[model samples]
Target: FMMKGVTPGPLLFQEQMPLIWILFGTFLIANVLLLPTVGLLTARIAGTALRLPFNLLLPIIAAACVTGAYAINNNPLDVGIMVLMGVVALMLRRGGFPLAQVVLGMVLGPILEQHFMVSAIKSNWDPLSFFERPIALILMGACVATVILGIIAHKRRLTGGDESS
Candidate 1:
């Protein structure tokens, strides 16, 4: 959609009602047809994937990631960056830091930046104006709460919890 200069949002809904209907119908049919069979087979599929020997599995996953990175733009730098990120992930794991948030941030950061830049440009580059939006405030509050909760949980883990409480 983006490549074709189509942004999939409310504007897309208004501009392309037929496309929306087609997408909705396709998703509805897919869920109805695939959900039950996929749900039933998930356990077996996961079990088989998990059963792979780590010695062999690690290389396969690494190769797949590297291949995917390079294949995206046929750039050697993409492969190098993937390998570097993998090493960074390994270091993070060794440091006992959670990888999920790091992975999430890496995935979301660019998209967030793009939208934020658009929002800022619309707002005359006033960053403070961002918090004026209720949704923005709510999301910021959620982020703060999550960080506080994570810190509390980490402290509890290190101190073996508050046994008295």
Candidate 2:
């Protein structure tokens, strides 16, 4: 994305708002289209997936991961940290804890905290001022919708996996 001049951050959200909307729109469209694609290809995908030798696949995946991590800024230390984090993640999984929420918190928590601090400073610490703008309502709607969809998807995955409604 940086090669395409599309770096992601709060600044990206502010400066590239239209791109964000476009991404959200495309993702919604893709989700709609994916259902039919999955329905048609599930059997073939399942057969292929079941035939995959996970024991051999693990080392290949690790190599690909290390290569990919190293490709980012060509940093060996970053690659090592990624491997360490992968080991930690594996341990967490073995402990029967859900990784998704943890991963989301790790990624989003700081950003959300930054936003909150900025918002408070800008509003003179006035919470109600956040909703004064017309755009705020739209943003709130989008956020609520996203949370609702995430919760629904999480529940469905937890309960039913691939055969979910």
Per-residue error for 153 in candidate 2, Å, reads 21
What value does the lDDT take at residue 2 in candidate 1? Answer: 89
lDDT of 1 by residue, 32-104 (tens): 9887899669978878998999998899887888889999999999998988998999999999999999999
What C-alpha RMSD separates each model from the true structure? 6.0, 12.6
The segments of candidate 1 whose C-alpha lies over 4 angstroms from its true place after superposition are 1-46, 134-165
TM-score against native, each model: 0.60, 0.47
Global lDDT of each model?
Answer: 0.91, 0.89
In the range 1-165, model 2's lDDT, one tens digit per residue, is 698898877799899999889999999999899878886699788787667799977777779888999999898999989978889899999999899998999999999999999999999999899999999989999999999999988988888776636
Candidate 2 — number of clashing residue pairs? 0
What is the alpha-carbon lDDT for the whole of candidate 2? 0.89
Q: List runs of model 2 lying over 4 Å from the truth.
A: 1-50, 126-165
Candidate 1 structure lDDT: 0.91
Worst 10 residues of 2 by lDDT: 156-165
